[model samples]
Target chain A: MTERWKRTLVAAALGLALLLPGGGIARADSWQDRVSAGSAAATARGTTIEIAMLDRVTGQYRDNGPAAHTRIESASVMKVFIAEHVLHQRDLGKKAVTQTDLADMSRMLRASENAPANRLWVAYGANGIIADIKARYGLTETGPTSNTRYWGNTMITAHDMVVFYQRLMDGSGGLSARSRDWIVEQLRQSVEWGDGGRQFFGLRDGLPREQVISQKQGWMCCVNGHIYRHTSGYAGPDNRFIVVVLTREPSGRGGAHIEASITAAVRAMFPEGLVPRVQGQIGEMWVRSGGHRGPLGLPNTDEIPVRGGAVQYFQGGGAYWSPATGPHWVIGSILQRYRAMGYETGRLGYPTSDEIALPGGALSRFQGGYVYWSPATGAHAVMQPILAAYAAQKWETGRLRYPTSGEIALPGGGVMNRFQGGHVYWSSRTGAHWVIGSILGVYKAQGYQAGPLGYPLTDEVALAGGAVSHFEGGSVYWSPGRGAHALRGALLEAYQAQGAERGSLGYPVSDAYAAADGTRMDFQGGSLTVPSASSTTTTTAPPAAPAPGAPTGAGTATAPVAPSDGAATGGDAQP
Target chain B: MRPLRPAVAAALVLLAATGCTDAPPAARSDGPAPATSSSSGPAPAPPAGEEEAQALAPLPDGVATGTAVLVYSGLGELREPFAGQCSHDGSTTRIEGTADTARIVLEVTPDGARIDLDDGGVRSSSELSAGRYEVSGGHLSLRADMTQDGESTGTAELEIDCGG
Candidate 1:
């Protein structure tokens, strides 16, 4: 009947629709399968390929066979180890690296210059360099060539390279942060034209720009009748992942052919680039909603499982999925509110609908409640008996307006909500009712519900001459002729004994106040005074006959009944 | 000078016919070539540098003498003549030679021989067919066509004495 109810029903229907069989969008392939298949296809091309991938966040490592541990010629990749050893020495102040040394290091890293590598290799003995790096990085299968004169002959395995990179990134490789970052920065600036030849093969050319690659490449021919092409690097945000591809093709393959083979292998592993793919039902919904460029933005993490289904956080928001709810995204302030309420484990449960736009703001519905947001009021949850009361009053369109805060517990086992228009109070004894206008002002003057007025028992009722709202202690009456006032305790009893509003003393025009004698209430016809509480007296015009057609007892004011099921019935009402 | 043996004269004729007349003698060899003598007491010892070069070679067997000529145009122009010994254990023969800083290692198998050439800093590898071999005067010579990236780049000529 109300706008809130209509929106809730619509959300419920959409949630139900998401639960149908095959409701999820279809995807061509999962990322894991695609990467596995791609790796296999590349290996089948007559190259002995070894791959190692490390997820920095999860500390999970993946590889495509024992070749990751099989040592091959390091080629120019040995330059990285050489650089690390030199930098570590520099870090310890054991060696003063001059500006010339820095320039040479940069040349060696960015351009893969052999002269600089050879110079550094001799300066820091080849055996010492290998020994230092091996001990520092715990490389199990990396060693110097028997003839240390040929730095390119240093043997290294993909697994050891990954471990070296991981240690370098985590600042445990005996290099200071400055040294580590410098090395990584030089790698990031690697040029396509290195001293040996084209360097932008494999990860650099194969992966998308989204991967943010920083790499070192190695290529050398006819070491034991095999040509080695290796690409190793940091990929993804903040270098959150490491990828190493080591390949050795039979001798005599052209440089371009070998490089392309490595690149194809890398491309196969990451068809969608290096940003982890969002897959399955969540991925389908993401595409439907515009994919990486959509409102959800790019997925910052892989789909992670929760209690019921899974959730994947994107740059824009988090997409949550469940068998019952399909997929839905909660964004902005509403998402913050839901998180504060404990996410899916909280009272609100999983989102049943995507954020729904309203005239002034937006709302997202959940199993237990709704998180509503407005430019002026931020976001807050609305649930249960209070929601029903708000729905009966037509939600935000009614007098209560938008809720300013979530349900807050009172000291006396009651709950209260502050709204733009007024306040909603709920207690087991008093049900749920809103206090607003001048009567609320008078109740505030009497210390609100916490004072003698207690909780509101009924909403304001319109009388022939004024309005009235009953509270636990007494009642507040409002009239244009005498303003609003509260009548309570002994004074209220004395006024009722003289027939209350139907008696000679009409609706109270002034709240009960402390006088020189005791507490007093001023009415239109007369006043009721309780001096010292022991006795109370009412002065009025001669007991006038009840006004013709005047109602008796508590008038027509009725308290809002709490919902039987206690389920939220409105889109934006607070509990 | 002592007269050339008939086998050596015939091998020289074969070498000239095969466009190897320009092949230079071992200029950087450890010693002068041994003179031919009529007496059959014992043979002379080989050059001094040959023993060290043979030890350094990545060969499976003992040393053998060889003359190597490599002509390649890929990466950069390389036309070099190296007089050195080759080595073979049994199945594979490795002929490694260096002219100044440029070096080339040719590994010959029954199927094919692979040439790993490094002319200064520019390097390239190419596979060549198992060449035609001729043995005369206790010397064996191999002539093969070298192909790189599936394209014929040049030819490699090697003559070695493996004591067969």
Candidate 2:
């Protein structure tokens, strides 16, 4: 074979790696083969554990060990079949299943109340139910106990239990829709039983509330000198699964072990080995997150297909999984960015955290970076130097708040991030510098680089009770007392002519405020006013006059001739 | 699909943020210009020199209290209206409204003014761009444009006395 073909064959072989018991990854033959291996592994350390699973979506039925064929005494779970038979009788008589009957069924199914079960068994005729279930529902391995007095001893097989659940969902068990629903409703009640009743420890114990089976439990101690623990019910969305677990343990203390084994097997069949419980505020947000004509709603499909052993797809988004990072939601634009970065296989690796709520947006942290989303900014990834800078600034709680725009390339090839409070500009020469407060306000108002003050030459510099920032044109000074003021043009020249801040005028009290008289800059002691209309002498001055570069009270005054470049170095200069 | 917009769509003259489809001619806020049904009528000039309401009536009982449902019209379309509140003191006036799923708070004072709006939950505030307040004939009308950060969202016109 060619080298490329050899590599492809090796990858295919690795993709088929089966997660076998005892922490071994064995190459599996197929999905069913893996299921068989898992079943064998589960039964090896047990006495007799039988499990039956039905995938309603694909109409596939699989049984492990002696679960399908072996007949075992159905303890209280037989109450479900008995109630079904009783409801069928009522349906045949064209009679409504009364509220009292529903109450009795609830007691029988939910609480496993023996009084109602015996009453219903006798009312429907114990032998007649067995014959009806066998003939009508085609359940071959189900029959009433030989001793009618012990109604709980009815023989049942895993196959018959699965069939019974199937008929309930398909509405083919000779029971009306209302009657069937009433029985199912009863099964859903009292899922977590108290006071040492058979607690929901089988199929229901291992799943989330939304995905747990509405199941019935059957436990009978010392029945034929063996303890029985069984749980069977329909689970998943729209009752899309029927799972049956029957264990005949030597001692009654094996219920926990039985539950764990069955849970493990069920999880093996699903992606991430866990269901996305989608609950509470997150559920409300997801179901109604999008506006009209937007792409958001409840899950459109029941199966969250496992792709590449990690990522699972839903309607709006999906849950990604990994051994290191666990599982987290990748939704909307964040999901878009994650996919663009090649998902978990790329630089972001696996999502190590769930979508966390921010003030105006949400973020999901990953191994390498984080994806943040806001209605205004959509979603974008923050990684490496930019992310590190944000973290040092305390992320969202700091001055930056949330990123208003992603890290965009500036016109001159530097990088910058626009945030709610300010902007972070980065270049190889300057590392990452934050521009905020009134200085940022002035910079933004001046149309950034597109306006007079090109790019910032230095970060904010500290002065006595104030701070100043240097730009291409001049500097913006800010203080708690004076706000922020920009000094350039003739204003800078006039201020420097009087020894700047040490002279008559203090640090600029305001940026240039317009007035009818002229654009004025206020100072601590007095004010320097520039005339909107120049005097006749200045107007009539010759070409060699200092009129263009001087700080006279004239409208035609220009910037002062000072330093060679008129730009300061990037440093926090102390006053 | 949204409807096509004409060049100069006639707007329902309202207060700064309040809007009503059928504001009667008599419902005109304190203004000098007569209420004209034609869309091309000149904007009523702001209350000239002595036209500002003297007593100001303390804004009526619950006019500035509780919530006022207001509709916002801009960019040639009338968005769905929502409810908010407005309040005024002697020196400052504040009009708060909700539009496009955002809370807009307009605060105008003698010295400085600001208008804040939310994009998602992050608030964006900017200096008031332009404002015209007229209290003519015991009616208060306000027309103002709002700018958040540096971008202009839209204008709001309200007839304050009509409890809009």
Predicted structure with the largest TM-score when compared to the true one: 1
| Tens digit of per-residue lDDT, candidate 2, span A117-185 | 766677777777778877877676677676554565678877678777877777866778988888888
Q: Candidate 2: which stretches are off by over 4 Å?
A: A1-45, A55-66, A94-103, A140-150, A191-196, A204-213, A236-240, A251-575, B1-164
Q: State the lDDT of candidate 1 residue by residue for A1-575, as single tens digits.
A: 99999877865553332222221113233433444545676677877787776666555456655566778778788788888889889999999999999999999899887667767888898778988898887787787776555677677887778888988987777899999999999999988766525677788777755557889988765444566678998986589778888888876665556666787888777655554556667877877787655688778888889999889998889999989989999889999998899998898888899888887888888888777788988898887677777777787777767788888788778887766666778899999888776776666667777888899998777665567789998887766545667777788788878877767676675677777777776766666678885675747453344333333435446422211111211222332
Model 1, position A199: C-alpha lDDT score: 71
Evaluate every candidate with DockQ and list the scores: 0.03, 0.00
The 10-residue segment of model 1 chain B with minimum total lDDT is B32-41
Tens-digit lDDT track of model 1 for B1-164: 11224545676687688664554556335552221111111222221122222222333243555556554311112333454446675566666767445577866565556778775444667676433444454455555566555434445666555533
Candidate 1: which stretches are off by over 4 Å? A1-38, A44-46, A91-96, A146-149, A222-225, A251-261, A264-272, A276-295, A300-313, A319-329, A332-368, A371-381, A387-575, B1-164
Docking quality of model 2: it rates as: incorrect
Model 1 vs. true fold: TM? 0.48
